[model samples]
Target: MSSCNSAPKRVGNKVKCNLSFFDTIRKRPIGPSGYQIGYDDLVALKLYSNFYHYEIDKLEHDSHYGGIFNLEFSLDGKLLVAACEGKQVLLFDAANQKQINSVDSAHQNCVNCVRFLNDKHFATCSDDTSIKIWDIRKLKSCLRTLHGHSNWVKNIEWSEKDNVMVTSAFDGSIYAWNLKSHSENNMLYDKVFLMNGLMRMKLTEDGSKMVIATTNGYMIIIHDLNLATLATDLRSFKPSLYRLMQISDQCYPVATIYNYLFSPTRKRNRIEFIDDFPNEAEVISSLQIHPHGWSVVSRNINGEENEEWTSVHDIQSRDPSDYENSFMYIEEDIPDEPEPEEPPNQRPTDLWLGYISLDEYSNHNRDPSQVSQNIWENNFQLPAMGILNSGLIGVNASYNAYFQQHPEQRNKVITNLPRMTHFIKEKNVGKGYIKELCFSSDGRIICSPFNRGVRLLAFNNQCQELSMCVPDNPQQLKTIVEMNDYHKDIVVSCKFSPTHYQLVSGCLGSEIKWYQPVV
Candidate 1:
C-alpha cells in the first residue's frame, strides 16, 4: 500500500520509501551485562520552586486507604509500579498514564518499596516482613513469596551482578535470595549483612556498591558491594554508632544541628540516636544512591528541632582522593594528569648549609598542600559537602564558597544535612525533612517532595550558583522546578522517568499525578 511521497514499497525482499528507516540487520545480542543509558532523547522538566500547581478539586483514591510510599519505573520505562500503604501494588502503562492492572492485598502490611526485575516481572517488599515476586501478566498470585525478615521489610534491591534479590527490614537484617537457580539455594540465598537501625538500602544501577540509610544517623556505604566481607564483619559489628562516629568521626551521615553556634567540626553534628538528644530517633529513613554510585540524595533527619534537609552526599569513589578533597577542582574533560608536582619541589639541592631561607620559599612550598593534606577532612573533621535547599546558611551553603569566590567544579560536597531544607512559610510537607526523593537516570536531577508540591532540581550543570560540587551556598542545584496547586495534599513520592521527560508523583492524599510536557 502506498502514496508517492509517503509510502512503503516492497520489491525483492526490500522495502523502499522517500524517507526510510531501518534497524541494524545484525543486532548485537544483549546479555546479562546491561548497556549504558543514553539521555539524549529525554525531555525537559520546567516546574521550579516558583512554579505553581493548578489545583483541581478531585477525590479519587488510587490506594484503597493509606498513602503511596514508594514507586519505580521498569527497565524498559514502559511500566510503573507503586507501593502503597494500603497494601496494594498499583501498576500503570507509563506511556499513556493508564491503569493496566492492580494487585490488591499485594502484601500483608504496608508495601514499602517496589523494584523491577525486568519489564514483566517485579519485586515488592512490605511492613509484613516479606518480599514477593510477581509477573505482570498474572497478578492473581505471586510467583514467589520470600520470608526472612523478623520485622517490616522496607527496602528491596535486586543485584544483577550477583543474581540475588536483597531485602532490608526494621529488624536490622538484610537477606539475599538467589534467583539464578530459580530455586532456593543456600549459597545464593542468605543473610549477606546485618546492622542495627537500618531504615533502608539502595544499590547503584551496576549493583557494584550499596548505600544504607539508617536510624542510627549514619549513611553506611559498603565498598565493592563485598557482601561476603560484610557478612564476615557482621559478627564484630557493634551498635556503638557513637564509638564508630567517634572513630570514623569524620565520615558519612555528617550533619549540623545549626551553624550559628555549633561549629561544623563538632561531633554533635553527626546524626544518630542518643537518649540525650531531644526530638525522637535520629533517623535517615529514606535515600537513593546516584546511578553512577558516586553520590547519594538523602533526607538527613536531625533530632535537634526535628529538622530534615535534602542533601547531596559524595561517597567514596574509584579514586579515593576524589572525595577526600571536596573543595578541589575536577575537570571532566581533562585527562588524568599525574596530579602535577606533588613531590614537594625538590629541595633545591644547591643549598650549601642545607637550610634554605624561610623567606626564599613560596607559600606553596612553606605550607602543606591544601588539597593533598586536606586540613578539613583530616584535621578539623568537617564534612566537605554541598546542599541543594536548606533553611540554615551553613547547610544550604558550601564551606568552600566561604573561601573561594567561585569554587572549582569538584564532584562532591557534604553540608549540614538538616540545615539545607527549603523553608516554606505555609504548612509545609515535612518541616525541613524530605519524605522521599529519586534521582534521574543520568544522575543530574532530583525530584524531591516539598511541602505541598515536588521540587525538580538539576545539579552542577555548569550554572554559576550550582556549578561547584561544593557550592558556597545551598543553591547548588543547577535549576529548580516546582509543581504545586495540582495535588490537594503534601507530595510524598516523586520520580523522574528513565527514558522520557515525564514526571510522576504521589501524595499523602492518595493520588498519583502523571506529569508530561504538553506540546
Candidate 2:
C-alpha cells in the first residue's frame, strides 16, 4: 500500500543536498590576520630564525705519496719544508708548490722536528736518536751530526747570538753545543749541562738565560756566562796563621739575584734552584697550574734601562747607635729637565711602561722658573705602562675571547692588523695531524698537512659554503659546506712557503705532501 505513495514520501519535509568537488577544493579569500606564503616567504622565515649560509671551495692537487707528519717554513719565508715518516725531508718552491729538492735518507727514523737556522742551514731531529744539520745551498748533509744524547732527542734550539745550540732528550739530559766548530769529533761542546733530570728547555730572546721545565714539574733558570764564580780553597801547605781570608778573586757566580717569577700552571709546577758542585738544590717558588693547561709567555723587565750604578757601601758596618741623633739625609744631584715640545702627529704607538717612581723635590736656592720646570717634570713618573697597555690591547683585540663576543669591537681591533686580510680553510689533501703551522713573511696564504695530504688554505675571506640538502616546499632553506676532509687525519705539522704560495706537510707514515695554492 506504501509503494503506491513513493512520490508522496518526500512530503515529510526532510531535504538532502550535495556540494560539487570544485567548491570543496576552492581556496579561501585573504584575511587581514592571515598570511600568504610563497617559496620566498618560507625562506625569509628560515633565514630570520634558523638557517645559515657558509661558502667553501675545493681544489684538486697532487697527492702525497705517504702520510704527512710535520711541516714548517723557513724564517725568511722562502722555503717550505716537510718531514715525512719516509725518512726524508722534502723542500718545495713556495710560489708554485713544486718539489724543489728532497733529502733522501735524511733521518734513520721518523723526523719528529725540523727547524731552519737561516736561509742556508736547517736542522732535523729524528726518532733514530740523532740530529742532522743540512745545507740548503748544497742540498747535502752538512757533515755535522749532533750525537750526544743517548736517548730520543725531543727538542733543539739554536742560539740567536752565537753558534751555540741546545738540545733536550728523553734520557733526562740537556746538552749545549758550539756549532761554530762543529765536526764529528767535537760533537758536544760542553758536558751535557746535566739538568739533573729530564726537562724541556726554552732560551730567552737575548740568549742570556734559559728556562728549564723538569719532569718533576720544576722550572729552573740557568744564568748565562754573566754570573761570577764563588770558590773557597780548603787545602793549604801550612795552617800557620789560621787565617780567615776573603778571596776577592773568587766571584759569586751570579749577578743580581731576585726571587723567581711565579706564574699559573695547569699542573704541579715548582721552580727549583740547583748547584752541581756543592750538591745544593732548593725549591724557590711553587704555583698551581690553571685548569686550562694553557702556557703563558711572559716578558721579563729587569730595570735594564733605568738601573742607576751605585757605589758599593758598607752600610752594615756603620753603627746606628753612633749617628742616631745626627743622621743626615743625602740627596743625589737631579738632572736638568728639558723643555716640553709639541706632541708629534703620530707618536710611537707601541710604547712600554717600565717603572714609576715618586721622589721628594728639594730646593736650597734656585730660579722660580727652573724650579717650576723641575717640579712639573718630576711630579709624576709613569713607567712604560702606556706601551704595555697598547701592546696588550692589540693582542687582546686579535686573539682574546672578549673581543670575539662583541662584533663591533672585533672589527675595530681587526682594522689595526692591516696584514690579516682573510682566513680560509684548505680543502682536500693530507691525512695526519697538523703538528706545526707557519705563515709566509707576506702572509698571503696558509699551508697545513695531515695524514696523506698537504692543504693550501687561501688567506682571503671570500670563500662560501654551498648547501646540498634543502627540503622541497619547506618553510626555510639554507646551505652549508664543511672542509673537514682536508684535515681528517692527525696532522702533526704543516708550514707555508717563505717566498711563494707553497705549503708542505709531513706525516707519521714517513711521507711528505707539497701543495701549491690555486689562485
Candidate 3:
C-alpha cells in the first residue's frame, strides 16, 4: 500500500512477484502423423517404453481424400496395390513404398475389393456391378471389363488352372467367364451354369466341384460336367419296385411273386404295375423301407433237398444272425457210413436262395420219406422262396427329420473336421471390421492397419531383446515407444509386401501409410 514500485519488496514475498519465472513447460517433438514425440536426454531411455530404436525416414499423403477400402500384393510380392472408395486403384513399390502408378475412375462406383491373380495381373470388383482385369505392365488402362452382373458384384475369384473367372452378385446369380475368349463380339460366355437362388459360390481346389451356399440355408454341390453324364445314364434304365408273397403249401408253387403299386408323389397314390407273378399269390405283409429315396436288393432261391441238408429254408432263418448260428447237416439217411460215392451233394432243401428260382420236382424214385432229394435226381424241383424280397423305403424322410431337429449341431461334427488350410483370428487391432487382410509371401510377419493405428504382428514369437538405441540419443536407447498411433477412424484395409519387410495401410480417410520394421 506504499509506493507502487516498493509494494512487492516484502519479506518471503507475501504477494507473488511478476519479475521473472522459470520455463516449466517442455516442448514435444513432432512425429510422422502430427503426434508429439516426448523425450528427455537423461530419462529418454527410461521413458521410451514401447517404441523401437528406429528413426522415421519419410511420410507421404495419399492421392484420394476419401477412405481406402482394400489392398493386395502381387504373387511375386514385389508390387503393392490399394483400392480407394473414391474410385481409384494405386500401385506402389513394395521396397520403398514409392507411388508407381494409379488408375483413376477404375470403377464407376466405389471399388470395394481387389485381388491379385498372379505376378502380372490382378482383378477388381465394384459396386457398379462390374469387374475389371488389370495388367501390371500396362498400368495406364484395364485389360478387360467383365460385364454381366446386374447388381453390385460382391466377389470375384480368378482360376489358376484355366482362363476362367467367377463372380458373385447381389442379384442372386453366379457367372463364370472365360477371360481368354472374351471379346466384344463374343462378350456372352460360351457356357452358363445358372444358380438362380444361390447367394454365394466357391469353387473347390481343383475346380471340379462348386459349393453354392444358398440363402435358404442349404449347400448344393454342383458337378457341372459330370451331372449331365449321370443324367443321361439314368434316363436309359427303368426303375421298378418289386416284392414277394407267401403262397400255400399244397400248390407246389413254381414262383412266388408280390405285386407293388408305385407311387411317385406323396399325396397322390397312382398305382402302377411293378412286377408280375407266375402263379396266383396273396400279399401277406408290406414294408415301406425308404421314405424319400430308392434301393434294390436281390436274392436266388433253389428248391434242392438232400438227406444231408446244407441249407435251411425258413423265412425266419434268413435273419442275418441265423446264418451264423445254424447247424450243418450231411445226408441224414446215410447213417454214419463211409460210402464209396461222395455223399449226394448234401443239397440242403432249406437253402434260402435269392433272385432266381428252380422248377418243381415230380420224380417219385427215392423213398417217400426222403422228401429232401438232390434237385438233379428229381425231374423238377419246386422253386423255393429266394431270399425274401422285402422292400424297405422312406430313408430320406428319416434323414430330413433328424436334420430339422438339431440343424446347427448335426452339421457341426461334419464341418469341423480339419481341412488343409483355414483362417483363424489373431489379435483384434481396430474397432471397425477388417475389410481386407493379406499375408506376405513367406508368411513371417503380418501387418494390419485398423481404423485407429497400423499394427505389426510377428508371426514367429522368437526374438531376443537387443540394446535399445535411439537414433539421436544413446541415453534414450533404454526407453521404449508405445505403439498406439491409430485413432478413431477405421482402417479398412492393409497389405504386406511379398518381397520385402514393408507394410502399407489404407484407412477410412482414403490415406495410405507405409510402415517398415526397424530391423
Cα lDDT, all candidates: 0.54, 0.36, 0.39
lDDT tens digits by residue: candidate 1, 398-478:
434532542222322233222221212122344432367887766656777766666566654321122235544444443
lDDT of 2 by residue, 117-235 (tens): 77778888765668888888886665577776654465676776656767765444556677776554756455334422343455544555555543232244444322111001111
Q: Is candidate 1 or candidate 3 better by lDDT?
A: 1
Error of 2 at 2 (Å): 93
Q: Counting only residues 3 or more apart in sequence or on different chains, how many pairs clash (N, Cα, C under 3 Å) in candidate 2?
A: 59
Error of 2 at 373 (Å): 67
lDDT for model 2 comes to: 0.36
The TM-score of predicted model 2 comes to 0.40
TM-score for each candidate, following the candidate numbering: 0.61, 0.40, 0.43
Better of 2 and 3 by TM-score: 3
Off by over 4 Å in 1: 1-63, 181-188, 239-281, 318-434, 460-479
Off by over 4 Å in 3: 1-65, 183-434, 443-451, 456-483, 486-488
- Listed per candidate, the RMSD to the true structure in angstroms reads 20.1, 30.0, 30.3
lDDT value for candidate 3? 0.39
